[model samples]
Target: MAVAIRLRQEGSKGRLFYRVVAADQRFKRDGRFIEILGTYDPQKKGENTNIDIEKVNSWISKGAQPSETVRSLIKRQVKAQASN
Candidate 1:
């Protein structure tokens, strides 16, 4: 089975919230997921991303590929955390 780490969209039409999840590559965007890693709220100003780096790293090591946007988010979050 092809595993993927990607975003699951939620919330209302105009407003959007996202959950970072580990799921099968064949599943629909918001379909069943293996686990919930964290969340992303684009509407928020600062610190809109809340992710578990440990979990993400584990999934990656297990061969789960992240989406383009999720990849960038992870990089940014890790960099911010390192600076603190």
Candidate 2:
């Protein structure tokens, strides 16, 4: 089955939160996921994303594609890691 890395919505309506997950491409968004990779909180300022790069790399190497937004987040994480 095709796989993807994407976000799952959660938290209250006005206060949105999301979990970054690895799941089957055919599954509905926010439905069954293979694993929880990390989180994204847009409401929070600075450092709002937390993802396991090692796990993400493993998934990507295994052929899991990330959504557009998730792709950007991953880029940011990589830059952050490189600086520190």
Query: Candidate 1: lDDT over CA atoms?
Result: 0.96
Q: Candidate 2: which stretches are off by over 4 Å?
A: none
Model 1 per-residue lDDT tens digits across residues 1-84: 888999999999989999999999999999999999999999999899999999999999999999999999999899989999
- Which pairs of residues clash in candidate 2, taking residues 3 or more apart in a chain or in different chains? none
Give candidate 1's error at residue 52 in angstroms.
0.3
**Stretches of model 1 off by over 4 angstroms after superposition:** none
lDDT of 2 at 5: 99
lDDT of 2 by residue, 1-84 (tens): 999999999999899999999999999997999999999999999999999999999999999999999999999999998998
* Per-prediction tally of clashes: 0, 0
lDDT of the candidates, in the order given = 0.96, 0.96
